[model samples]
Target chain A: GQQVMQIPQYQHVQEGEDFTTYCNSSTTLSNIQWYKQRPGGHPVFLIQLVKSGEVKKQKRLTFQFGEAKKNSSLHITATQTTDVGTYFCASVTSGTYKYIFGTGTRLKVLA
Target chain B: SAVISQKPSRDICQRGTSLTIQCQVDSQVTMMFWYRQQPGQSLTLIATANQGSEATYESGFVIDKFPISRPNLTFSTLTVSNMSPEDSSIYLCSVYGSTPVGNEQFFGPGTRLTVL
Candidate 1:
């Protein structure tokens, strides 16, 4: 069975602090996606990385895919209260449409 | 990404009962997936629902317990049969398809189930 694990199961940071969550997979993946889930809300797609060692950024957030395509990371710069939520990384293999979700990292930013 | 919706945002049920959750997408899609997130846990895929055929259940999941129906390209249902307290969790419906960025997945507001 394939598994995706995320580091820092929970993170608490002060406003303007930086936070990062790492994701690793047991097997190679074809692509990886990052999602943000607000409290009592659904998961919202953030970004997807397909090429090896690819990096994508959105405003204050940055995403990276490993060269091996088996891991990824999301880094939030100068966090704000609005950034408080859970961040998840989902990976897809070449043969399946199903996503393997990583152990989410719940973020809490204090003012 | 597609706009997806799920019926019965939240429900409370007693043991030994069954509940069916419905999912509808605004546009047609080729595949729909069901996932379960237990309290303080991450998302676990239950099955993949494809149009006009039986669902492909993940390991540790079975059609007998979580029967799925893919009547069309835009709708599906997941029924949790003979429920118990352990069945309490949030069920989510997700769809994957083309988007402006690339092929991506979008999730519906989950159905929160509480079994007692």
Candidate 2:
């Protein structure tokens, strides 16, 4: 069985603050993906990391993949009200196209 | 990237009733999937919907409870049969677009089911 876990199940922050969510997998993964779901919205793909020690960024958001490919992180700088949502991390395990998602980190930003 | 649409944005059903959710993709896709998002929880995969063949379900899921039909490459349906209160959740349809860049899955708006 494959399992993906995330930490800081919930976080409350003020505008202009920073936030980070960590994702870990029980087994090695072929690729890792990040998604964000706003209140009452569908899960939207944010980014994907494949190679070990990989780093990618979009605007103020940064994503990193662990050297072992079993962990990943998503960091947001100067968070805004628009950043309020549940961030989920998913890992594609070996021999399957399916993805196992973490419990997710819910971010709450106060203006 | 592809645009996805689902029918019956939300529904209220009595216990033991069933609901069939429809999923349509703008572009043809190879693999389609069904997932459940429980209240305040992560998404759990139900099964992979394949065209012209029976769906391959995941552990803890069965075709008896969640029957799926993929009649074409761009269309699919997931029927939650004889659902209970535990089945009251958001059922989503998703797919990975055919592309050479990478595998990126796009999700539908989801059908919110509330069983009483």
Candidate 3:
């Protein structure tokens, strides 16, 4: 079975500090997607990386996919209280479109 | 991404009882899925609901306990039969295949189930 391992299960940071979460898969993935879930809310899709060694950014958030397509990272610069939530990374297996989600990294931003 | 709506946003049920959660998508989709999110835990996939076919459950889930119904392309139901305290969790229904890019699942608000 394929598995995705997320580092730093929980993180707490000051309002202006930086935070980073990593996702590594047991095998190469077809694509990787990132999501953010607010406390007591469902996950919302943020971005997807399909190409190897690709990078995408939104506002102060940067997303990157490893050259092997088996690892990914999300980094936020100068976090805010509104950034508080759990971040998840999902990737499809070699043959299926069904996405397998990581354990998730819960981020807490204090003002 | 697809827009999904799940019914019975929250419920309280007794042990041994059964709970059926409904998921309706705004538009037709190829695949639908059910998930469980325990308090402060990550999303765990329960099954994949396919239109006009039986659902495929994950490793830890079984069809006898969690039966799924996909009567149409836009509507699906997940019945949690014979519940227990461990069944208490937020049940979410999601859909994929509205966008042209790779399949990215979009979830509904979720049905919060509490079994006592």
| Residues B9-92 of candidate 2: C-alpha lDDT, one tens digit per residue | 999999888999999999988899999999999999999998888999999999999999999999999999998999999999
Clashing pairs in 2: none
Judged by DockQ cut-offs, the docking class of candidate 2 is medium
User: Which model is ahead, 1 or 3, in terms of lDDT?
Assistant: 1
Worst 10 residues of 1 chain B by lDDT: B96-105
Between candidates 1 and 3, the one scoring higher on TM-score is 1
Query: What TM value does chain A in model 1 reach?
Result: 0.97
> Which portions of model 2 show Cα errors greater than 4 Å?
B98-101
Q: What are the RMSD figures for all models against the true structure?
A: 1.0, 1.1, 1.2
Task: Give the C-alpha miss distance for residue A37 in model 1, angstroms.
Answer: 0.6
DockQ (model 3, Cα): 0.76
DockQ list for all candidates:
0.88, 0.78, 0.76
lDDT of 2 by residue, A1-111 (tens): 888999999999999999999998878888899999999999999988889999999999999999999899999999999999999998775798888789999999999
Instruction: For residue A3, give model 2's deviation from the true position in Å.
Output: 0.6
